[model samples]
Target chain A: MSFLSINSIAHIISAIIGTGAATAEEILYFKDIRDGKIDEAEARHLRITYKIMHWSLIILVLTGFGILAGVRIKYGGTKTFYSPVLWAKYTIVLVLLANAVLIAARKMPMKWAGSLSLTSWYAAFALGRITEKTREIKWLADFLSKFNFVELYLITMVCYILAVAIVAIILNYLKKIIIKKQ
Target chain B: MSVLLQFSLISHIFLGLLGIILFYAVLMVLFKPIDFKRIKFLRRVSLLGLISFLSSWILGGYYYVVYYGNIVKPLIKKSAYPWAHSIFMEAKEHIFLFLPFAALVAVLIFYILGEELEQKQAIKKTVIILSSLIVILGAIMALTGIIISGAARLR
Candidate 1:
């Protein structure tokens, strides 16, 4: 397979594994805490899950940008740095990822972790959708057509991060019911 | 934006957010070692979240078909990438997709695996792990979708 194919497959596989780790960790984290072993398991699980997530993130950024650049070259166009969508998307991803690191690394409180994780995930999805849809639009097609893959990847992450923060705020406000329950 | 776009976007955003919230909630409860005091509340919250997330996904999918069929279809008759599309979107149409399946399995596995262990602790641990995976997978899907779509520019 070509580089793109390989990258895609790798991303998928990594996602599966990374998610599995995350899933396992989340469950175990709660278990450990209840068992009064949160301290012991927290570091190990955090390190492993963080590493997996970080590497998967690296693959995501690399491949994401590569795809953008490849597309621009294929379409014989170039997206400029001033692109609003691009800038927005990148900013969002940055915020989301930063929060994720803080939470996963245990810098943030558990309450914040829940809120932050929710924010980051939503933001990523929002920005991703925006970027994808914009590209599909004829008017947007030409404008976003520029930039190397790396550049686009950067922009996409930014958007993802910002989107998460925005959504998180809303969810947090509505968290009254959940907070009460817990 | 137009009505369809607005409708689609709203649902998309809602479901997306719902999924994230539910995924995290599950993790927090599961990872924290099921306090009997928190069990009823956490389970209730999780169930609600699951309902909200699923509803969002359903609405989001509806919007995808309607909007894409109307807008993106002319450019690319079928999905530009059939294999990826099938795994992520098409297969998801029937539910029991990778994510929900993984989630279900996590729930079942947690119940089975931790049944004999400390009730609250095992349950919490199992839920957290499962939910965390689902959340991460969701993130990957979102990121990869963009990358893949952008890459299609190459084809």
Candidate 2:
């Protein structure tokens, strides 16, 4: 396979692993702590999940940069590189990194951090997929193309924040139900 | 750009990233209880972070004005990714100005407060908030740098 193809495969694999690990972490942590108590085993499980997510994130970043560099070198700059969707994805990834740090420091509440982490990973993953398929959807391409960088970013963030809020509420409700069941 | 200028740009980015990482270390340290040993270590790291930020500012500013403005900026502005210049670069350059000052404050807090930080909740919170801001801003700057580099490739 070509360099770009190899890089693309690696990038996709990293994203899948990273986002999957994040989702698993959220679910496992919430499920175990339904009664609002984290036993040693549950804590250990969460830690392992977090380690997976973190390592996957490292791979994702490295491969993502490799893919970006490869594309620029091969294509000499495509509109995909300049897309606001890609920029927004980058911003969300940074937020995820920062959130991870805060979560490590025990500065942010776990639920909030979990919500943000999952939201960011899924958003970035979705955007990456959409950018790949943009050429196949002319209207979608045209629509995204009209948005300036700031407008596109702001809209994406507002949407992501709303999604996080809704997810958090649903998780909270689920936690209550699980607790009641026990 | 010249080879030396390229080296400067690379070093500038490297140091900026290092400074941000160190600031994150400072935040992690401050979040917990403050002991004298940790305080001393935090002070040293904060100083290093400040130095790195200042050094990066000098090198990157030199490159931005000397080479980028005259050469890379025009090319990027003409490329398909002009917003990479008009939006991201503009934001990155302006946001970068806050970093050195934030680093300075972080260094000053650790230097002046030391073990007293454990008892001073308000000041401790201020330090954490500032460090957090530095990390966030630094991350944004790094991503913007990538966009700018990508845009430059079009030329």
Judging by TM-score against the true structure, name the best candidate: 2
For residues A1-182, what per-residue lDDT tens digits would candidate 1 score against the true structure?
65445654664565455445545545555544543345855768766875675565555544544444333333522332234555455454555555664564366766566445544444444555556577678776666667655676676666554654575465555454444544
Q: Which candidate is the best by DockQ?
A: 2
The TM-score obtained for chain B of candidate 1 when compared with the true chain B: 0.62
Clashing pairs for model 2 are: none
Cα lDDT tens digits, model 2, A1-182, are 86568878988998999899989988897688777699999989988988887777766765676676566556655666667778878878878888877776777886687789888899899989988888799998888889787898789888988988988788777777887887
Which candidate has the top score in lDDT?
A: 2
Candidate 1 regions exceeding 4 Å error are: A1-147, A151-182, B1-5, B76-96, B103-124, B144-155
Compared with the real two-chain complex, what DockQ does model 1 have? 0.03
Per-candidate TM-score against the hidden true structure: 0.43, 0.73
DockQ of each: 0.03, 0.23
Question: Per-residue lDDT tens digits of candidate 1, residues B19-97?
Answer: 6556555564453444455555455555555565567667667766676445543333353545444454444444435
lDDT computed for candidate 1: 0.52
Worst ten in a row by lDDT for model 2 chain B: B1-10
lDDT of 2 at B100: 95
lDDT of each: 0.52, 0.81
